[model samples]
Target: MQSSISLPRPIPRTALAQAVLLLLYGASAHAQTPPTAETMLTPVTIRSGAEQENAITPVTGFVAKRALSATKTDTPLLETPQAISVVTRDQMEAQGVQTLRQATAYTAGAVSNYFDSRVDSFSARGGTVTQYQDGLLRIYGTYNTSRPDPYTLERVEFLRGPTSVLYGQGSVGGVLNLTSKRPQADTLREVQVQVGNNARKQIAADLTGALDQEGQWLYRLVAVGRDSGSQLDHVDDDRLVLMPSLTWKPNAATSLTLQALHQKDKSGSLIGFFPWQGTQLPSQYGQIPRNTFISEPGWDAYDTTNNSWGYLFSHQFNSDWTVRQNLRRTVSEVDYRTIYTSFTANAATGRPARPVFNSDNRTVYRDASWQINGGRMLLVDTQIEGKLHTSSGTEHTVLAGLDVQRNQTSQSSWRSVTAAFDVYNPVYGNFRPPTASQLMRQPNVEQRQWGLYAQDQIKWERWTATLGLRHDSAQTDTEGRPAAAIDDKAWSKRAGVTYQMDGGWAPYVGYSESFQPLGGVDVYGTPYKPQRGQQWEAGVKWQPPGQGISAYAALYQLREKNRKTTDPSNPLNSLQLGEVKVNGFEAEMQASLASRWDMTLAYALTDAKISRSNAGDQGQSVASVPKHTASAWLSHRFASEGRGGWVVGAGLRYTGSQWSGTSAISTPSATLADAMAAYDAGDWRVAFNVINLTDKVHITQCLARGDCFYGQARTYTLTSTYRF
Candidate 1:
């Protein structure tokens, strides 16, 4: 255990020109425009079942399954057992995603790096991706933009390992749920349009109708716009999104749903830097000329603004009874500004423009939630159940529940900027943006969380069980007193056993636990204790109604309790010492066998470690996370029921090369290949996408003076949709 190798705190050009003049007021004074070929459609997925988040569901992560045609329903990452990856809405429109870090990029271990804007905030498996949409749990200062553009999604669940039980200050590296898009009862129309390359363009529209005509009430509206230009050099990307939703039913067990959203992102320079030691001076050394303008020529920048409102209610008073209620509220405001150049040890290569690190940031957020699911008791089915004895005949069924949440993220910033060369400045590129002094800052942060939960489900015989308990109280008010707070008590457990294998194959096994409450702190002063993740699972859940096709495989282990650092001779203090491990194995497959050849193949192999970092850097690994990951998808359809349907799809992604710091000094692995082609005629549709299909070239080393930073290259798109 030897520790020596750290660097990443060199962003100062007078503090990036007073953080770009404090975010340039309200931007768009006109000037600084470029990015748009076409964009309109707006779809962003986040909740689905009936198998299609890459198929293979047999209970492995946090339980949420129901299939009959959500493509087919395999969503049983097992009610929080651990390990989850689901991103479907026909695969985010056959791949054209523009955020949430590109819609979970092929999910596997779900590693994300959201191109700047402060890494667009994402970290999973090894932790730190604290974001929630429908159920609202927020954190992301200046929050950087709402980023809604997967066409208004309805699926995006990647719960692959560790969730503090309904969320309690999380991220042992896992949790992402975007699910938004509701109002369906009939009348639907989907439209699309796209053009590719760095000059890509897009347009999309979604319409789900029912207002009169005796259809109670149902409506859905989505809108989006985008413009792009990338390959670096001043960078570029522009966006706008708006979403509206409504759902209501008065019979068959009351129901109600309402949602609203609005987002805008006009960007450029979310930290764009090159020269991993100047790749000897070629990867475009210190480049930034595409018309030289890091924050002036309209100032290469980024902006974000968000607004949200929500509600979901359901009731089934009879027929064994049923009750559920949900509510939500989200508000966001981010006026982010940036001016590249995070130091490149001087510089020289394809260059001619420099300013360096600046920000006029602002982030504000509020989230609310309330949940309740009542109980019921029913019987009669094969007859033979009990609570201590049953053999001659019997039957039983029972269920119970309760839940609550109130989340928030309040941020305040009074930023400033100034820079004139600081990569060890020796004459660095043309540099000039604020030849003065103004190193100012106003890094303010606030967080508040509240959680209370209770649940139980028990069914006799063929055995099905569930038991959960959560009690968390969180409070944080830095910048105004009360630095940190958390009083958490969590326990989530589930046991499953299903057997009816008579050729259609059916097998199952399960158990689970996960919890979180640590927001980075170990420089002593103590504030890092509240990460209890535990897991042990077994698998097999095939065709119960898995009908048309189904499959599953599982084996897992994730344990925790042992952490301590920041005693470097007493800068503060920390100690927990003893225990941390991750073991894994997973497999999958989803129906349509001899019916159309639709498919989803899966694979996962992990062995993260720190067995005992007590020795400190002892065996590192598990930051940014990746031991082994995999995903595969194959699609096919050529129906002739009406002579108008043809589609083809392909996918692959593999990541295995961790270490971004901690003395290991960066190593951002890569393995990407994607393809999509479609042509359907009900109204009209077309597609063609080939991201990173072979333009691979990645690097993310960070040692500062020594340098290292390169990523983003390879893109293509072409689309069209019409439904009138």
Candidate 2:
């Protein structure tokens, strides 16, 4: 794309050379210093999985003592004054979480497990959720981005509400941040092998330790290989993942960590968007099995690979000041091909219907040709943090930072029509696939962002207040379409106050705002303004002293405007006159009730409505948003005889009814059950998890008349892990 915006240049060679010289000088100047007691001490990874020594209290069960997403600083969750949830590694392992959605299924206000079976995509409140890695934004060309291996992460944090005050451009609903396992001073080794339904098999290994006796160098390696089958007759899912990381500490005040990952996924499209007649309701042609494969086995294909590398460097100039920098580069490619049934007849016909075919036969399909997609991203951020005391003897934590990001993607596709086939007994090899002559290419796109932000946390006695502000400038361009270019600027702000009372009770209130630049232009060829979101929240938190329980309840309302809606006059463009509002409440509790029992409880209620729109959607309920959701999980552990023990866990999840975009279509409410059993002996543990234990069949969501998606069916997995 031709653009008038000037891109930032790389660091100058002189500056790079100076940095190298300074590094050498620093190392040589401090190499001969006498070793002391602090030098002999090893770096400790706290219970919250934080590398810093001064972290929150040790956490167990489903409760996390601290969260990093709320402030980008290590702060206790109870004192952050923001609604946040952390899925600890212990919790994910207990649930046998395979996908990101499964890892957060029990969290309140998170609605997932709907579409994008290949990737992790969810909605919080009433807006989309964006994924971040270690507080850095990962560029996504579309909603369906590359999926990261869940096993590689040490934890996942969700900050629920407008977060643009820290992150420049983002969805107001929330942010999901994945923290990768890094090298720790303590030596650790583990190996795991798993077997599951559909002939699935997997092997994984994790190793971390000091590379040298001086403990100045540390390294970690993680690898996984998997092969699995899907619910479809011929589709399969397979993957290979590898991650390597290293840390170098020249002194106690300075540390550098380098991390890299490579992943390859080979699978078929998991989408089974079936006609409403046969999927949502019974049809005259009889019902299709839950595992039916309507698409041609020969034409379906999905192959993708992702590579990412990053580094985190932190230096403490003194006891009260620190500087840190983080940078990453990522590249990904995708090849997809599938032939899906687009639609069916509106009337109760006895067969599938298509416009290309002359008659409505039991089988009618189109040839969805090959599609290629590619993406690349570069992100960099540098910040300085300091602790200061006010004139009144109060304390303050201040942080200032600058960040830049550049991302781009390209896509091209080919397709053609096809003849009909019988549904009862389909026959293949009769029709030839489309050729390269019918290919179509989409315009290559690029987006760039630059942001500057600052935050201050003021503490006086039992009262803490946080204030933040950020300014962002972004631009978007299309390779072959100059008219689609956009340039936008936004300012975001946030403020919160928390009062810590005796007996471990904290009451808090917060307000935050967000802005996201929209990509396309309106019908009149004028660029649309960025979407603006604002939220108000109030909550109370409690953690009784000496008790193993943490509880919280929050009430919040969020509204967004400048949304784009279909333009009836042109049909080819959109108009920016849409708005949505969500009013909700969330409550959750995690407790270690006794010596052998642990439990978690959660509930959420969301009322999302279209306040304004230009497409006749005003006053309608937002699609895929259930009004009420609740869940509970309990586990019991049996005493062990020397080196053996056992545990059993059960959970229940409830989802209330929700309306589709179409007023007449509604997804019915449903409840599902899950169970797990595990045995621990010596250095090994064997566990089994069963999801949807009752084999309930329900629709996760129905978007329109002929669009319906079934919830995941009953599935089980057995895993064995050995520690050395």
Candidate 3:
């Protein structure tokens, strides 16, 4: 489906002038300073003293004590006010995470819905979570954006609550940030081979080292290629990814890094569904097999390609001041096609009747349909950061920058009817092929946006405070009969305070707001106002001495307004009076116990409702959002001191019942299990991991009336890695 609303043209002249002036101000402060004796003796790079410390932080275990995504600074996780979860590379590997969703499945306040396999779908606090990489937005061409392999990432971080103060526009639920592998001064090389059920075969490699003596130049290269089969019969998924980066430091206080990525994916059709009678509820027909293939073999196809490059640069003018800048550009394209059954015919004299399968696993269908679509997208981002210390007894870290983005996407689709297949016992090669003449071009949307933001962090004595503000302007343009156009602007802000005490404890409170431009107009032809979100949060964090545990808990309430909903006067159009409220509590504990045991435990309880709406959905629980979720993971390793190196791990996850699409219908609760074992010797390691160990079959979610999806079935994988 194409977006009905479009972004307008370039921002007003005033906005453009402001961006130029900001850039000039940053450049004017770059006066050259006399070379000191220490600077003359050795070349200093950007990651000098403080930067080098962060770069070398060990990432060998599940516990991530420090993160930069929360405050864009080297702040410890325990000091951040809002609820935050970090999944380190070690944690992902131990859990046998193959996809991005799997990496966050055990974190508090996070729910991963992977029934479709076509897109990365997840919800936090009753709203969809936005995607980010290294503090920058990761643009998606459509609902089905490609997911990066877990092996290519260093860690994944989740920041819960409204964050528009730092990021211009986003979801009220929060943001998920993936940190990529970057060049390092240390020499490291590793390779791994993996194989599992479903014909899964893959190889990955990581190499990083200093390009020259004195560690002035560093480089890193990562690559992965995989060929795997899906639980769906006759369906296959394959991908290839390549990433390379280079870092150069000319002096102790100056450094610059350049990085690039190229990825491609080929997969089978994503539209596979059975009617309500046979799938969601027991029909007289036999239960549909989890691996049933609903689409014709000849018509199923999906392919996408992406390319991106960017740079990170920073310089420390003196002990009290520093400046940093970042920029990136990306382009992506996709092509998808599929042919599947639409309606079913009854087992008795099936012809001409909306086909319904019978108890004997035999049925006939009235007909089928073919759908074809393709599109392209482009994205860009650039920003600058600065830090300063005042003459008074206070410290200041500030950021001022501008970002501009343009997205142009177009889709051409064709649909036609053909002969159908048996529901229980399927047959292929029956549907007729669709033709180009039947294809129709959808409305192409071109959206452009520009935002200017500034933030400051102030610290004095044992007290810390932060304040930020941002301004955004956007224009959406659509190409169709009338060539519709709309322009919008918004302002966002955030404030927070924290107090630190001696026993490794910190208590904080924060307030933030978010906004997102909506795409459609009301029945009266008036553009709908952008959706707005407001949140109030309070939390406490603790890190006990010598216990290796970091824990936190938070309570929050969020409300959103100006949402678009069905118009009562004209059922054909939309209204902007929709409102929603969500209240929740989240708690988490992660530790490396006694240097031999690692454990992580989390729990979340949420209550979400449609507070107001033009339609008749008020007072109902949000669809697909469970009220309670909990998880626990534990692992133990035996050292070589008394026995051969070995490790054992296990985990459990539980999700409570939730409204599927209406207050009257709901999906049942479920529990899942996972286990892993590994052995290490002589710089080599072997491991076996199992997901859904109990082989339980349950629906992750279902749509009203007839469409439902099953969660991942029991699966196992074995991997071997060697380091040199």
Candidate 4:
């Protein structure tokens, strides 16, 4: 517990010196230009056919037919009526994904049963998910941000339930947009190298095209460098990333794009909390060695540094009207330290105190923490889109928007009570590091939000209706902290309908609403209001047409209200009456099958609980949620007779039993396996991947307020790619 703050150099050096002076002014204007003929036919008519199928382009495999975060327009996910999932960029390079929870590991009501390699703790149908990029918002606070690098993503969208009409407040379980990989006018180059097994090593690159040639100046650069090691033991998983983008398009009705991001993360903390009696009810000093390294290896750390820059503008006031704007600015920093297990006190069941072995069953007791977080964010979004047609012929499609957000945060913390290791005979430096009078400086928080939205979809003939509305105003300030300056206002609504039957199905139904504002106060200080949610979904979608396949199924009932619980007659105060409910079902399928088979399938069942509470855990069940989750993947390419081929894949993941929060301890069920092989010749490609293949030792959740979380073992990688 020693951190006097001072952490701010994980490379951003002035945004890499303004990205090397904008890459030497776009390489001296394309090596002092010279081409013509409308710059040689403008990169073959600028991304043909509906601009290559809108919504952040790039999809040729793992089916994705338009999506702009469920109705931020660009529709079509079978006419969007909620429930959306798309993980594309060729399905995260054929499932060799590295984070973003492994590219939504077969998403379908998404959930990422904790195994934190420093954040990306996801959840969807059972609440908490917000994190948008390119569609604005990217977390505001908590463990200070920075985590986005699935090779700088090209897709990953999930928009399940309550989206607050169009992204305002958040988390009634949904929205996880992330689509970055801009600037492209054809040409692309790639280079990749990777090696696996905890000793991992990596390199990556992806460059995009036309800086001139009248493709209206496009450019892109993506880079990644990594050094890894995990599966516990003295943890480490490093990373450095840089992303650059530029686009100008000064013709076909105006456009702009400018993006930048720098990321750094030298990690540690692959989440360890141990206890739960040697992990999930086991004892006699057995268990707890899934590559154990319970913190304190040079004092555990989870470093982070992030920088961002943005722009995305569009204009086209003709052929139907359009206007768009998006902006971003982010700065983040974090340096967290950790140690684990520590408990005491159970004066006749006042709780906490269980796990005091040591008569040779191995010592325990520990505690430590040191955090220094920082954040800054600014986001703006402005929109207007239209496509009318009235005269009783229906066909609307309107959208209106205004969005703004600002956040500034700072925190410093420290805690202590260490020394007492030996989780089965082990030892470490005697321990001691909490000083500065045990610092705890928090109060430099600021948050501001603004939202105003409207939407319409209409259409007639095959019927499709969708309406939305939103209004939000929020504020939160604290400078020296006495906490008071929390203002919130909300209004959100959405309605949906769809019917486009005639072979490719489309039935849909929706109703959404969400709000969130609660900050703190109870014990009579009162000041916690805002946390309302509602959802009722119904879905069915199928995409037959040209048959690259797509399918969906959904059924839902979500609820939330004030939620805070535990003041049952002042047990240390906290009350909002609390309520939560989730009843769900989801199914998904994506296919490129038959043309060399590529498939995906997912299933979810969730039935989260706690419907109304005054602290007596009403109906429990909803911690790391999992009432069955399933996944499947299949791949096959095999062609080889010239341009080269041969690809193989296999996958499966399942999680069933849960509960360990409203704990009556229940954490069983697990299944994992994944494999992949690749080869291609005319552009060199090579791959081999594996995930939890058999070295499975489960336990991804545990917490009756005493540790446990581990899953993910048996990882492998080997990749080599080249393309020009």
Candidate 5:
């Protein structure tokens, strides 16, 4: 284990000219806009030609209608079929991406951060990824749970692969839906106001209409809040959000929807990004000052809070029969503690400053789902499909369904100042008055899980196909005496072919499989087998998105063999002779062009590996997991040149160099960039944004063993909006 890292020959790029002078001072933060909050939208319509969409399940078998829900680009991301990614709300408002760790780092093969400051993780294609909203499933890690807050979201997607038949147990390196925000007909009002550079205050709002007067009921309401103070110098954050929704159609085969969300957050921790040794670039930042955080450390500080509510039911009993149901109840909690000091270059006492440690945790998760479907019956497309085809006709469109997903995630944990409990040392800065016997106690270690799954999807005519089989059973009880339960069952499959193009090419080929579980328990109570992942995909799908602008390109090979790692001196002792393989390629191009120029460009090339480990062929490479990632967005609109006023948008992003663990420990990050500008007059708006445009030096941590973390070295924000 040696490679003291040596390289400095002409290595004075000065963090690449201070990241091109902080991306030219954030590409010169120009501003204006009417986008302050109301779930900020209105910039979608990138593609407007080539209509015909269907797939909530055709891509895999039950993820059907979604493109964010198109006003264009809403809910139709190239007609699903696996290997998906849609972070839209107009690309998270041109990448001002707030939370869910900045919207899973612009997808493509997701990779998140915040492992130190108490966990928030992600991994895609190669393994480790969870958080599904509309389709259930949620598990955030580092002792699992707590990573939800993309502002109650309305678009998140990202269903790559291995979803135990509609999500039972996870990690084939995929899954993260989040949608939820329906209720619309038009007529809305929005408000957003922002101020950046610590004291970075923010406000958000939304209002929808059409309640009666015959419109058959439709309403919506949303709110958001953020009180910031960090650029990392002892971190600080505060957030609050509320959501309301309702939709009902009195005729046309029946319809109804309902929604609710309430959240509170006090954040800090999520700042780590050190490794330049002593200082330079923006002159060595992060002391809890990317806005402010340190939450419980040195003087004791950390206060995080969460609250959740959910309910949904959908019905359609006429378009060949349909039924959908959802229920959610969540109670989230987090409290942190941290102490800081870092600046060590002790090569014989040349520099000094050390003392950094922290911890604080809390979580509660719940899940449920039910669906039933029937289509023109006759099975496998033979109700005179294509008039009873013969080796020549083509008309097979059959779909049958029965799905059930039930999730009960119960977890409780707190490990701070625990030397057998009753340990207090908070009188210095009054760490919130701790001295009731140093507050020591035990008996809050509980982790439980429950699951059940089923699926099916098929269509023929341009060769659309899928054969999904599911039977996932789980029960992991730790604290209820039975410590572990596994009703193991599996059968997952997918086969594909798509070729129906002429001005918008549609080329496809596929194979898919996934499911993994074992919440906890393996001290010999036995029961662990559900780690199967397979995928070989080929792609080409360019759209006119309803007909106007569009793009897509994909080439992939993701394979996971008997993968299950974590027996490192018995951390619950689970083993499965690991093996991870990820070969990736993706390219996309979005356009509005000509009529006011709208843009989007995405790219990724991953080569994740750990080919074999568990003390065998340790073929490393899989820490922060990154081979290369690219992102883009450009906007222009000068319209009538005057009058009401208009102009908004600009963005560029890049991520490269990863792997700080999985045995490789190959830390790499510095090809980062970001910028934004906005203005619109009439309803009023203003904007400004800049992030790591070249603040370089990046790293996302994940270490529960002797701890480690670093990320977010540069940042900026400014916003404004009002429309009523």
Candidate 6:
């Protein structure tokens, strides 16, 4: 089933440049028309010190005062009445993080189950999280999307719990928003080179400043090139990224930022799906080496290319009202191929047993798969914000918005059983290629969704209240498969209240809802109802006045219904009669003490269970969710009369034992260590970092289905950066 609709082509550079010029010209013309009577009557307030902190701006230290993710407004974290975590660029640089998962390692309620280079797979509050860039959703389809490079982002934010009131149809866990680096008025130029273990080499540059004397136009360019090898043999990690942005501020009241991205990745899968016998449990042949390569060296590959163009526009009619519009289009393609171990029938029971290991415990059966996937997505959002005062002296901030999204995807795949290979002694080019008959053509899928939402924040005295509601309608069509088409409509709501107390303490409570549409029909020919989620959370935030510290502790309970489960009446079919519940507690604190020391502490406790299900597995623990996780990081800088200084840091991470979704198997807990040392001079800095300093051999997780994933090994890197 080939797709009849062709993919959209990239916009020409000349056309794009012309369009930008026209927009700037029009904006300038409008600015010259001068201020209206209404604008002249409105008062403008200047922000200084901490009041200048906003969602997209650079932070001075580890603690952030304001974030825009919770309410899509520049609201103080203490007043948002929700749990949010902000990972700043300073924090990422200090920790030497290279991936999204690594950047959030210290955040409460965040978890990563395995190590994979192909994608950044992580979860929060025991459920998968949706990814967003600059307030717009990043629609992904069947391994066709490219991973974001951390170097190109200003900050990463994690919002805990359901957020459907703002973002349409999404996971109940939360939303991970990546803020891109935008043009700035202040000039900045920097270049960095890095070398690390596993034959890694990299270079990166960031340049941003004003483009004209009037400071009306600003531009920024960021690029990275890297080549590295993984802990696994014969697998490489390579990437190229280029991001450029331009901002036009014809006047103080209106601004527009144009951004474009091009990224390409060449990497292979790191997971081998090794049997539990040799990796987790003891075997006659002893433990298998962690670097053993299971897939064919030359045939195994995961390559991707991504391109996107977007703009963020905002205008203020007056001090009391403002409007904003954001739009983006993204196209991605992926070529994936791999070989993994396959289970064989048990000799006596005739049931599928664990991956068949030879008597020597060195050979295993395998299967191969190849796929080509393409995806295109377009997103647009428009919103109006207003501030009003009631007759009773109460203040109100209201917001109303409409957002629409379109996604199209195509895939063709083939799979077949392949020859077995010995793990101890490798042999390649012996397996047969997949035949034409083994090819499978998947239906082209197209989905369109639109949402309308409104929110209000009322404030009187020392109390604040928040109320929100949203309605969403979605349609999904499968090419040549009308029977599978789906039409879904849903309503989401959110409400919260907070009371500001003396000494910088705010205790709040909030309730939020979410929904995700399901596509296929059940065995009875009835369409499955969309999965629904709701959460109740209460927390207290403390950020003492004039203190460079922020802290919060929260408790939440979330429930999700309509999950798919095996039908007891018909084993071959499935039913939507499953439910899950997670009760969790989280606490975190970040501080920059007296400009000499920086530290962060985090702890999380998650209790997740299958509350209801048609299958016999009711009451079972959820897979890949740990019961306890904690981390702490501390760094100190030694000042040397402003000429140069030395900094040193160390951190520890602990993951408690987790259930493998089965009563008979459980993954063990492990704790790892990380350390960094750096020296800063007038215009240059050098740093050395070591992750997993002890090189502990541990299993991240294992499945009852018969495989285990290995944790990352020790890694070392040296980086030198120069600023001009």
Q: Write down the TM-score of every candidate.
A: 0.29, 0.92, 0.89, 0.32, 0.30, 0.94
Ranking by TM-score: 6, 2, 3, 4, 5, 1
lDDT of 2 by residue, 510-560 (tens): 999989898777768898999999999999998786666778899999999
Q: Show where candidate 6 strays beyond 4 Å.
A: 1-31, 35-48, 343-356, 432-440, 640-644
Candidate number of the best lDDT: 6
Backbone clashes, each candidate: 70, 1, 21, 0, 82, 0
What residue runs in model 1 are displaced by over 4 Å at the alpha carbon? 1-83, 86-95, 98-157, 160-235, 238-266, 269-297, 300-437, 440-500, 503-509, 515-528, 531-540, 543-636, 639-645, 648-677, 680-724
Tens-digit lDDT string for candidate 6 (133-239): 99998756768977888899999999998999999888788998889998887788899999999999999999998999877798999999999999999898899
User: Residue 579: error of model 3 in Å?
Assistant: 0.7
Candidate 6 structure, TM-score to reference: 0.94
**lDDT tens digits, residues 308-398, model 1?**
6655554444444344444455555554445444332233433223312222111101111111111111100010111222463423233
lDDT of 4 by residue, 260-334 (tens): 889988887776577677777868868878787766888678889998887777655456766677777888888
Error of 1 at 457 (Å): 26
lDDT of 3 by residue, 263-323 (tens): 8888775446555556667766557778888777866766667777776666555654555
Q: Would you give me the overall lDDT of model 4?
A: 0.79
Error of 5 at 405 (Å): 32
Top candidate, metric TM-score: 6
Superior candidate under TM-score, 2 versus 4: 2
Worst 10 residues of 2 by lDDT: 49-58
**Candidate 3: where are CA atoms >4 Å away?**
1-58, 340-384, 390-392, 436-438, 481-483, 545-547, 640-644
Query: Scored by CA lDDT, what does every candidate get?
Result: 0.50, 0.78, 0.73, 0.79, 0.51, 0.84
Global fold similarity of model 3 (TM-score) = 0.89
Q: What is the Cα root-mean-square deviation between model 3 and the actual structure?
A: 4.6
Candidate 4 to truth, TM: 0.32
Give the TM-score (vs. native) of candidate 1: 0.29
Q: Rank the candidates by lDDT, best first.
A: 6, 4, 2, 3, 5, 1
